[model samples]
Target chain A: MYLVADINVEICAAKSCKLCTQYCPEANTILYSDEMGKDQGFKYGSAYVAVDRCKGCAQCVWVCDNMAKNNAIKMIMIDQLPKAALTDNITYGEKSTTAVLASPVVG
Target chain B: MSLDYVKFSNGFEKFMPKEYRDMVEHGPFGKKVSVSQVGSFKEVLEEHPMCAGCAMTLFIRLAMVAFPNPEDTITVGTAGCGRLAISQAAIPFVYGNYGDQNGVASGLSRGLRLRFGDKPKDVVVMAGDGGTADIGFQQVLHSWFRKERFTTIMLDNEVYGNTGGQESGMTNRGAVLKMAPLGKKFEKMDMVQMAKVAGCAYVATVVPNNPRRVESVIKKAVLIAREVGSTYIQAYTSCNIEYAIPTDKVMEDAKAVENDRYQFTEYVSEEAKQYLTERYGYKEFLAKPAAAIPNKA
Candidate 1:
């Protein structure tokens, strides 16, 4: 059984800082996107974790909290995550799932 | 005539480095490729249930990249932390008895050779230190003694991770584990030297921090096995949860140990080294002191 870990990109200071990737022992487990905040002036990349591959090691959470000082990544119970985030047909090598939480975005 | 260029879809791109992105586009990352690229080939092992940040997971991924042919390769697994990848791995995998990993691989090697003499498939074993060094030591030794043509990759996490982090033969002295509450009394088992004494044609020890180096060594080990004989690649991984080491500092500790205690060594028989140099122009093989990873704790 795997736990669900999501990344909050809205408040995330996505600047291509690959602390999670650097710290993640699994390859391609945490992917980054630079296009999200390009218009907002910062060039840091938005990070997303591969839920299927995530073993709930929480290294991403550790890096985000301790190293980056941004509590952008949260580890949630698999059942608590939205039904849409969990998919049976996880096409390997495709980063299809976006780990947005169920809580309403506060704008 | 002017051509109309359509915009790509929203989900087409993920967070990937430019170098990796370019390679994935051609055929490796899921596209149809006539040939598989070591760096970008679709991972056969997917969603293993091992602990997140488990070093074995990373080692499997790196080894996959170094694999000569994922399509034709047959992966053999034994009991331990390495078993996590068996079900999810893309290639055809066989789960052997804990103490019979080498025996299974040896039989598979011979069976493949009998069926297709010149085109025998590659057989690779993913085993933990406990399975490789302690329980299955005799079978592994006999396989190397007889020169079985298979690659055995040992993911040495120092302790028996699956069985609640008990001290294994590979556990170093002075480290306190559940089995060794008062700290281990014996020094770590030298599997590298054991492989050499057992007549392994190719051998190397590496860590997960250096992906490129891991890829290079695994690729070399696989090549040597196919052309020469049996090869053993032992990778020093860490059991973060079991070892009481923080998850974030796992790689740091692995690097520190490699730099401070054990110097990473690569061994190749004289004949194989000559063959590699002559055929592949491979001259960059050396054993040197590695820089230590900073210890935060």
Candidate 2:
């Protein structure tokens, strides 16, 4: 199981608070992408969980629920998510258009 | 060791947990990070199982960010709501028995000093109001009196939040709770005054309303504790559940409390003032306005 942003991206508060992205243990697991926001009809970008990189620590969920007071994230079984969302080459907003970067494995 | 263990072996890096690897590379272990740079970096604290909108957890998170030398820092925590988030931090934590945090930290800081011998190894005791002002009052006072080289932080929620809501010494007078059926008879214990009287070199009281100020206070306290005598910081981290504060209104309630009772106050001894001025070149660290509370609304 891994964590996912299951709530409406409009109320994510990723651009302002970004507590989940700040506290997540894994790097690149949660990223704020402007392109992702545009796709979701949000003016400012919203945070999304890269399922392949997420360790299911639920740090994002906790921060969203408690710190940001926005219930925008949740944990779900890996099989419950579609296979398309579970990609090793998870691209970020504008940066992904140039290069497809794989999740960082080491420091 | 000398922060060498934070790195993983060349071939074995892939096998390591992403959290551990990320901490080694991007975590604020040996770097200088302020509260403003919070979201851009990986924090030492991770996901916690504490209550939603827990002010104590938020305080703990900000405190973790303020450690001057997180790689060499060791925190001691007692059994309370504070520990639920403290023990989850990336830094090594010593979870002592009920109200034994000060006692444990006294020995731990001494041991670290002997072993490191001038190398900075900060020992911080973070506990709830019941643990500091009530259950471990003796140890806390004695440790300060003995001038142990460490920092003691009281997460004062004004009530015993962990083992059901009970009236603690820090609880304000006329506040009705479980044990105090007819409202508390006495005023809240003035631990801030007691800490000053007990020979703490640096003492301060703050609320977690402003993250930057909280960061500055904690960093200054930890730095002072390293060179000066004992230091103390009391943070008013209200309990949302016990106090019946709405999850969304936690920060608002804290702001209200800060304005009414827990105004930001700092008491730096002459020795500490001189040390800070000379060492860090901070000439006006103590000249904060009486009402420094920012109107962030």
Candidate 3:
């Protein structure tokens, strides 16, 4: 699986548009979170990847780079992620998670 | 060979992926040539920092492959996204200030002529639409006016992509950009006509999708520029980021021009033609299926 390790919040339009999430083939691989919105001083939200289940397909990255025309998402090699990679963010569904997370949404 | 190895490979197959194999088998510009006859000895450039699937990368690669001699060739780049990506080019490159590429090429041409004398040395200027049509327009005109013996190529992506999609003189009239929120006010500059008026020996507009035409034209341009005078080749490149499209759609967008609005133009001076015929035995220099390249605005 690939990791969306760095989301350049500044480059992202940050309109909480869920194109990336909607385009992902895997379920729950990308989850919309309000934390990124807080970081960008927006009340809406932004998309976060569940790196473990990402599968590195880069569909989300393609969506962000092409459809959205925002270079926010970067599909990084899993081996390149730091040891504390998934420890810094609150992932979706989980009551408590940090940094990054991913899952495929069925339906 | 072992039976297992025989099953895995064909004698001619290089065992590379289909795309790499195609590039190798069909030659760099999609033509068949022996390994020894390939234009450049080695791929001078292997990597770039341009946006993934940038059209400029394709044009640059084709230019490198079309060059007859890489050892004696020097590329000068001016500011813009094209220049940004050329930083890692395998060939030697000089980073000229925006619009100063022609001036740099002029000086280089003179110096190379003085040093090499009879030996051929190519000095190619790689610049963007903004550098050619706007920022560096005057210097380019002056260089052409002086008939500098060098080839100047403009990778015209329409918009000033590197500067956050600003409107450039080459940008389409109705195209909206950060600087032209409502669309650009003026029509795009007719650089071909301008070049003709400026006394350029050869001028051609090409699209990167047509590798054969690109290779033929650039090689001809380099030769004509050396034997005759200045040559200008403006390649219609698409800016996926600025155009807000998928990177893979750049070629589609570039090809769509043939159907409507945009048309290609190629012009060669009599002097250049005579030089080609005399030096290279090119009987017909003007006839290259002109329909494939539109001549009108």
Candidate 4:
């Protein structure tokens, strides 16, 4: 499990209030990307989660939902994700995807 | 070991978790950082399982930032909501039995003092209202009366938040809750005044509405307790869940409560005042009106 940032509704107040980035226990798991916000046409930068580094603590989700009141981040179960959905704008999922694909489920 | 132990080596850096690496490199462990730099730097607190919009969690975060020497400081807490976030911090923490934080801290501070021998290992006792005022009242008072060289901080959320919204001694009079359905018959214990009378060199009552003020008061208390007698800080960290306060209105409620009764107040003994003024040049604390003088025969 990992976290994904919804750039549309998660209009992050990146520099002004980076609560998720500051409070996340793991380092470099959450980063403020000016380019990501610019690509999404947001006036301010937004935060993105590094899927490979994220421990799925859901701390960022709590901070975003309660403290920031933005409700922009959500936890995604890697097994439930469709194969094609991995190529979407949820950046930094390639590593997790390859690892998951390398080990096929033997039910 | 020296502070170098907290830093990572060049060759084995990759083997270390990025959390520890960031804490060593960008955290406020040994460096001088303020609350304003919170977002720009790495915080000592990690992801906690406390309730959403928990005021106690927020205060714990600020207290971590206020530690003058995080690398050398050891926090002691009891069974309460405050410990959930406190134990998550990167610093070493001792979670004592119910309401035994003051007892544990007395021994821990003395042991650290003997081991370090003026190296400055700050031992802080952080507990909830029930832990400090009700369950551990005797230990807390004796620790102050004995002049144990440690700082005691009470996270006053008014009620027993962790035990399902029961009433505590720190709960305000007439505040209805589970155990006190008819409302508390007595007024809240005046811990600040108690601390002053019990021989605490410094005492302060604060709320978490202003992060900077919280940091400053905590830093001062910890620093004073290092050399002076014991110090105390009672922070009003409201329990939004038990109190039925809306998450968004948490800060507003704190502000209202502070204005109504728990206004920010600080009391420093003459010795601590002289020490602070001489060492840190904090003369402004002395400018405040002194406590009323007692009658002498």
In order of appearance, the predictions have TM-scores of 0.72, 0.77, 0.63, 0.75
Stretches of candidate 2 above 4 Å error?
A: A1-107, B285-297
In model 2, the Cα lDDT at residue A63 comes to 62
Question: Residue-wise lDDT of candidate 1 within A29-107, one digit each (tens)?
Answer: 6654444344456655355555555667776776678667878888777656553122222222333222332322122
Candidate 4, which segments miss by more than 4 Å at Cα?
A: A1-107, B9-11, B286-297
Stretches > 4 Å off in candidate 3: A1-107, B1-42, B286-297
**For model 2, how does the per-residue alpha-carbon lDDT over B64-108 read when each residue is reduced to its tens digit?**
888888888999999898887888877889999887889999999
Better of 1 and 4 by lDDT: 4
List, residue by residue over B66-108, the lDDT tens digit for candidate 4. 8888888899999998888899888889999997889999999
How large is the interface RMSD of candidate 1? 7.0
Candidate 4 local lDDT, A1-107, one digit each (tens): 33333323235733325666555434334555445455556666556554544545465666667777877777666444332121122222211111111211124
> Which residue pairs in candidate 4 collide?
none
lDDT of 1: 0.69
User: Between candidates 2 and 3, which one is better according to TM-score?
Assistant: 2
lDDT of 3 by residue, B20-105 (tens): 33223222232322222221122334435567556776677667767766556789988888876566644568999877888988
**What C-alpha lDDT, on a 0 to 100 scale, does residue A41 get in candidate 4?**
61
Report the C-alpha lDDT of model 3 over A28-93, residue by residue, as the tens digit: 335455555665676555556555444444545655676677778875656554432231233222
lDDT of each: 0.69, 0.76, 0.67, 0.75
Candidate 2 lDDT over residue span A23-74, tens digit each? 5534344655555566656666556665664555454565677677878876
Candidate 3 docks at the CAPRI level of incorrect
- Model 4 residue B102 lDDT score: 93
Model 2: how far is B227 from its true place, Å? 0.9
True-vs-predicted CA distance for residue A101, candidate 3, Å: 31
Q: Could you tell me the lDDT of residue A86 within candidate 2?
A: 28
